[model samples]
Target: MVQHSYAVGMFPATLISLKVKPMNNQEHDEAVLHRLLFQINMEIADQTPKERELFSNSSSHFIGPPQRIAEDNIRLGLMIVLFLAGTPLNVTAMMRLRRSMLSSATPLKQLKQHLNISDLMILLIYTSSQIVWLITVDWRSNDLMCKLLKFSHALCFSVSSNVIVCIAIHRFSMVFGKSTKRVTTVSLWVAWTLAVATSLPQFAVWTVYRPYETATWQQCVSIWFVREYDIRTKNKTLLAEPLISSTAYSVYHVLIVFWIPAALLIICYLRLAMVVSKEIYCECECVKQSQSTPLTNGNMPSTDQHVTSSRRLLSRIISFSSSSSGRFEKALMRHQCVTMRRKRNAIRTCLLLIVAYIFCWLPYNAFFLWGLIDHDSYQQWHNTSIAFLRYLIVVNSVTNPFIYLPNFRSALCSSHAVQS
Candidate 1:
């Protein structure tokens, strides 16, 4: 006899029995156990460990598709174009600025010379790093090369930004403050120091690492506070971790690079505009007063000699007042006009450069910030927009020389001519 019992929830148990000829007890139990084990094995074999983990953890990141070959070619092509065009322009700018400095030691001339040097250094470092990446097909084989490229990129970018800020500040001081020459010289040194200090962390934050031991592809990526996972497979994964959290870094970059400099520039230019306008108004008023003033002579003579002498006396009085105030006013107006013209030219040059920088970098920073806040959405946007944004950022360096130097070419040439 065999008996089996089953119980349903919230109900009494029921027992059922079947009568049969006696069999081996051990064999009967062994056969039932084997059937249960087989069913469990079949269920377990249906799912892989990775699949099970994916199902369990809904928050895991999804990798995006790799960049297409055509995209890579297009990017490399654009970089080459930038190198060809920007390199010569930057070199020319540096040479012209050097020659100008040799002829004059004025504060304004010194500022231009420093600006050219900064731009030249930036162009050389940025272009060289990019060319290396293009030649090596993204530095797949050389770990040291990757690190050097990443470091140079960061350092040059920071230096460029800080140099622009210093330029703006110098212009602002020249218009609004006393002792501008000394202040500008001090600021230039400080700017270079700050740039180097800020960019030094790139060395610690970035490195070339093979995420998968079996894969041939190696990535230049940030490894600070990073957690790496190695999954052996044919598909390659691209993952980067930064020393600071993405949110923090994004905020810091936007604040330091864009917002602060932009605010300073706007304030400086607005004040300069006011000063220029005031000078114009005062000059106009002075002219109106001078014209309205009537000539006075104490004695009127009938003789032609006396008349001529009287006219000459009136002219002398007008030119040289009792306090010489009229003569002083004329001198002041001439000085103001020259100063205003110089300030206007400086403002125009700086404004255009600032606009170019903002236009090129704004989109890239916007997308970078968006990526940090919503990664899944970022992945979708990145496929379409990242290429263009990256190109714009790199292209800014190329566009800068044209914007800065072309308008000033005549001036540079004239100075060179005068020196000769």
Candidate 2:
């Protein structure tokens, strides 16, 4: 009878010792089991065998640590520095170009009045809208703002891309006098229309998602709900489900925004390159004439000095322009160099400016394509790469004017010096 009483006392003592919180499946079952053993060891101080054995032999279960997020934060910091530094350079450069556009005379019958001050304003507004999405939009408290925020983000990216394309096309056409027809006015409308059409799908499909009924917030906004859709088994898409919104987004991006525009831009660039090269040859001729004039006499230099200097200058010019293009008309451009080189110093600065743009922006293009590749390089590259990519995108946008505006400041200063 004493043994039975003692055994009953043991049960209460063991129950009192067990004090553990609930854990995930892999956890020490640290639940009542761990607590019970601990209690037993403490209560039966003299024996102490059972609880020690359980603790010694227990399987360990630890949740993974958060290392990845920490790595990303560091990378993002570096990018922010580069991004900030380049922004003003880009704006100042674009402004220089704007000044040129406004002051420069147009030979065309119907000049584009739409381009005067509006393009810059549009670019500023679009960039500001994107900044709001990247910095402030949180769906938890504001569903409407969130949707509008995402749509604005997509709109800015698409419009900027298309607008750049329009700028490239317009610049190329004006430089070369390719089409006699007044096409710049029509092209602006077309570019905006395409931008809207491309961005519309993102607005149509994106929606705020509430994963937990009591969580008081929605999470995971984007066309890529990859994991969510991967886990989903429902055959039908619902307006209410986040997965459906994501699936539509994935399809839209894959088809409309990325693939189609990439191909079109490539063709546009090719045409532009050809036109620009031809224009360079003409500009080189102009420079050659300018160089032939002696600095003091204002009379043309002797033929021998003219020929030698012209050839050297032309080689420099062709090399500068064709190096980035990789599709230089070598055989054709080679003959032009002799006559062109005498004028080399005239446009040497201009050619170098173009080279800068190609280098800065081309790597960005490669990186952009890499983002779409289904490979581990993108996933495991650490946060550093993503941070770099983010900075690169913003930097490219801002650095463009600075790099591409050939002979911009020098030309202006030279003109002023001449006036003085």
Candidate 3:
């Protein structure tokens, strides 16, 4: 006899309908199983021990096509590469930032340091977790490990995005010549608070679920639907018991994690570009004027002793004032040059970070939103598209340290030397 029960699955879930009856021979059982497999649209199945064994033995007959296995293998390779590449890069970035902070402690540098830390979390928690996940192809760990890893996964994205937003705001302030230690401190606190609040829901949704008692395959996934018996039909049907509607959850996550931050980044960078352009234009005019100044004659005229003494006396007072004025002007120009260079470097680095963010995450979010709008699109979407987009998200974390640390190293180190 076959059991009737509901099954749950990962994202892009759909309702499943199946009919079951008692069967005597192996051929009859296989026929019924084939029909049930064709009808059920879920990844995990909940059934009795005997039926689960039967399902497991007969599963290969109609499941896990070669293309799906190849996609999984590709995803696994990508994750492993990202994990190995990102770990050392983020660690090196943090170390460099730490050294810079020791020499010259500034709020902007602190924000970047925090950004590196967020990237490290992504590498350490999320990327590595995915590597293991792809290898095992199931939840081999305990319930607590599943919850913690899932929570950390959510936390990594939330914290990294929030920190990037904070960096943009701080850079915007710097360009406008108005940055304060207090504002930076408050902004960081807010970023961390929001990240934690957004990630807390993962604990409620994700768990290690054993779909079959005698089966070793277990999944750590969201339990959005469960199987239940319908009294009228005496058949099992999937019932929704989600913490939040899937569409609503997707909307909230995408908005908080990408859309909102992207909007803010665009506004900040546009204004920043305008201000920097004007400043650079003004500098060009100053350079042209200085370069066009004519050279003075080298010859000197002979004069009498009394005339020379009178001229020399007057010249002493004039020279003193002129020297002081020249020194002050030189100091001012040097300071401005340093400030302008730093601003240009900041713009370059932030632009790279923003571009990388958009490039890496845009397709994934677009796919997610599209899937929410049209469920069939998600179901019919190519597995390669899904795997590639996911790989890109991890690539975002991997590329950040490279985008950030190299550009800032010279500037920060020089600033430190100047301060000393």
Candidate 4:
């Protein structure tokens, strides 16, 4: 009896035995052994189709189908557009902001400039990764690189979202607290630190995973734990589970990225609007009272002169009430006017940003949540919807400059004129 062993791809080695009749010739024994090996090869070849069928069936249940090539081409084209458009827009916005800051380095202007910087970082990180994905089939070949890319994408997104929140908070403080300066250097540093800390978990949760154990391509996917499944042949297979639970992570992401910021923005802007309306109403009343005041000469004053005389009379009344009170009232009114104007401008800029954020991010987050809740149904349109949503998110970065740059430039020019 002669025994031979052979190993096939991803399969255990097996031994086959060949029995030969008694032969005195060594050459004949060798030839018989060769014939038996050839027969074994033919049998193995005949079994290849069944093995492939099993693999295909098992893999289909987990890995799903590849994305349609037409959809992929469209997605790639859109990503290229984002890269071309967002890059230049962000760079231009950053430069314009820097130039303005050089001329007038106020706390508010600095905060706005910092926001531009955050958006720029987000555009760079996300667009670069997206471009790589579009260009390469197996971009996640290296585990370390995969983890780093996923971490960076999350970090940039969190930082940008938090920065928008910071802007809202800063405007709220300035409007309600009657403060000129908001968002100090310390506060900005703290905001960024928190953002970075919030995003750190991504590095731990994401890693390179092989959807098919023997497949050449690897995916960068979120992995919580190892799960084992028994297939038809009693073969056990392992799959990666999500670390934070898909539902939990989806809820957390939506809350942090969308709901909280949207709520804060709405509340702050509404309160600020009411405050401005009240101030304008009071100013109008003061003007009417001034206009109604009779002149000693009994000659009606022109509109400009009437306004000036009314202000003077009010000042006298305020001074007569108490000199310190009069001075305080004048200073307060001046501060209120300046702060209110700045607040209105800030609100306008922030409203555009918040609206853009919602428009771009909400659908994507909603889809993600839906996928988590009912993955089977969601998988039907997963490739198409996700690709579109991702492009929409990138569009936000591209649109920000167009939406806010004009306002920023006009504000900058107005400030220069006032300074002159």
Which predicted model would earn the best TM-score?
3
Which segments of candidate 4 are over 4 A away from where they belong? Answer: 1-68, 178-186, 211-217, 224-244, 292-343, 370-384, 407-420
Would you give me the overall lDDT of model 3?
Answer: 0.61
Q: TM-scores of the models, in the given order?
A: 0.66, 0.50, 0.72, 0.65
Q: Write the per-residue lDDT of candidate 1 for residues 1-420, one digit (tens) a residue.
A: 222111100000001111122234323222211000000000011111112222121122332212224544565576678778777767777776677668876776566666666666655766555555545543255667645555555556666666677777777776666687798788778877766675555555555554334535444544421232231121112322321343244355455555666676677767766776686677667666664663233222325444775877665654555346646666766776676676667778878877887788677666655644554455445545655665575577767766666555576467779999
- Number of backbone collisions per candidate, in order? 0, 8, 1, 0
Q: lDDT of each prediction vs. the true structure?
A: 0.51, 0.39, 0.61, 0.54
Task: Write the residue-wise lDDT of candidate 2 on 1-420 in tens digits.
Answer: 000001101100111122233335432232232111111110111111212212221222221211223333443354345445544555555556556667764422122223212233323443343333233222344656645545554555455455454544555565565662456657667866876676565454445544334534343233333232322212222324543443344445433433455555566656655655676678677656544532332232334455775877755555555454333344334556753552343233233323433443344334434433432343335223433433343454554443345564586567669999
User: What C-alpha lDDT, on a 0 to 100 scale, does residue 5 get in candidate 1?
Assistant: 17
Candidate 4 lDDT tens digits, 173-267: 76566454634565677678876776666666556655557665554544431121122113322222321343355456556655676677677
Q: After superposition, how far is residue 16 of candidate 2 from its true place, in Å?
A: 46
Per-residue lDDT tens digits for candidate 3, residues 253-372, read: 677777898898889899889989798778767655544542222112324334765777655655666567557656656776786788788899889889999898788667665654
TM-score ranking, best first: 3, 1, 4, 2
- Model 4: what TM-score? 0.65
User: Which TM-score value belongs to model 1?
Assistant: 0.66
In angstroms, how far off is 186's CA in candidate 4? 4.5
Model 2 local distance difference test score: 0.39
